[model samples]
Target: MNAQFDIRSDSTQISFEASDNAQLSRLLDEIARNEALPAPAPENVFVGDGDYRAIGLEYLGHFVHIGGLKPTHRVLDIGCGIGRMAVPLTQFLDPKTGTYEGVDPVNEGIEWCVQNIASAHPNFRFCRLDVAHELYNPGGTMAGDQVALPFAGNSFDFIAMVSVATHLPAKEITAYAREVMRLLAPGGRLFLTAFLVDAEDLSRPTARPRFIKGEEDGTWIADPAAPLGAIGFDNGVVQDILKRSGLDIQRVSFGHWRGIGSTHYQDIIIAVKPE
Candidate 1:
């Protein structure tokens, strides 16, 4: 019963059970053992508030610094849950030259990260802010709401938001886009993912409902089609919002889970601040 993370860059977020690959499973188990990560926590069935969010976050973190992180760069992990990106990031960071910050709306997520991992490390910081890549906890924050960031502008060098925009509505996406601009440092990079498409090709819709009516504010929420959250992105509208926020789109890539099919492909976006 080890808690480890086994992730390779080429691997996508596809279902592991379906593959039935013994070697991959053993690889994952080995990685888990090294990290002391608990046994596979039934990520396929994300239930309740503490679904396998941590698992996804961990995997995303694995991808964030996939190739490698520079020695002096700082990292901001938005929607950072548990110690997914937060914990693994420590390995890549230089400790003195590098800094790490994580934000999460769920207090428990932030609390767990801070207590179990961040607090003990002086160079590392964590807050309960929910803002993504925004200037909330410039010194390693982990709290932010739908709107409003507490950090000064251009506070981070590198920020990664793993599947944060996947569950947001248009307005929410707009908010995240604006915040991303404010939080990124000049020449900084922001890596994130979305479940929706911005380009209206008549093939893709803005949203396909996924929640029971009145689930929260009687709002028609996106159907929880995916295990983690909602899916789909607005048609380039998010990129436009970033323009107004003074941010520019650097690159966009489409990714598909192993067996999830085209409908669930993630829109990988990399936005950069003006150098």
Candidate 2:
């Protein structure tokens, strides 16, 4: 199948496109024949580490129990790679009351979800945006900072962007943060994961850390030329951005990226729009 679609722009300059997930469609049909057999291989599920399935399932639990996502809520999943969260969410979301909207600049991932998940669950929809990121969509036409989301204001009750901010520069991150805030309804919750630099790490200024914990500064860029190669922000900066985006920090679970005990490698933050 030719992997391309028509790109449309709206009054707000939001670009939109939806691909026919031909590859995933075939895979899903094949899996349906053998219900007991394990689903498609990990690579087919998503392009990530072997533990992606476990991580995805854990995220589902956190969103529902900790972030207060409910069956009746509308969800907007930014950077929805494949169907990691969407797969588990299929079992949790009420078909009649819940609706899921996932958008990603990577067409392949969105196509997969459109075929494997959206085909069976009409309430779930996948969209493609042309937001450019050096790591993910270098050839994309739209700049990440300038691309307004296709959705209207106050559209979602729950918004999740796992590991999305880690690859974005401060300007781009701020742009996306504000967009998330715009899409969220009053009292809506947001779950975001990113690499956070601590004051202690900044003070020490490790020439080279054991892991990718980042430099002594609160924000670290692995490659100055390629901002998205790997970026880390200080705790203060992260909080200030969230506050300016109209979100109040409900919980912040620092990650072990800095050698601290953590449930996930990347720091997890749960914030909510003011009621």
Question: What is the C-alpha local distance difference test score of each model?
Answer: 0.54, 0.71
Per lDDT, the best of the predicted structures is 2
Over 131-235, each residue of candidate 2 has an lDDT whose tens digit, in order, gives 887778889998888868899999999999887887777778788889988999999988988777765754544322232444444567766566566688877
Off by over 4 Å in 2: 1-40, 44-47, 201-218, 222-227
For 1-275, candidate 1 gives per-residue lDDT tens digits of 32223232123222222123463444444444454432223442221233343454445333433412343567777777566565544443555666777766656666666776665566667777644432223343432236755677888888877767655555666776677778878888877776434323223333233223324331332443432255454446556656776777877665442122342245566778898
Regions more than 4 Å wrong, model 1: 1-33, 36-69, 130-146, 198-228, 257-265
Overall local distance difference test of candidate 1: 0.54
lDDT of 2: 0.71
Worst 10 residues of 1 by lDDT: 9-18
Cα-based TM-score, every candidate: 0.63, 0.78
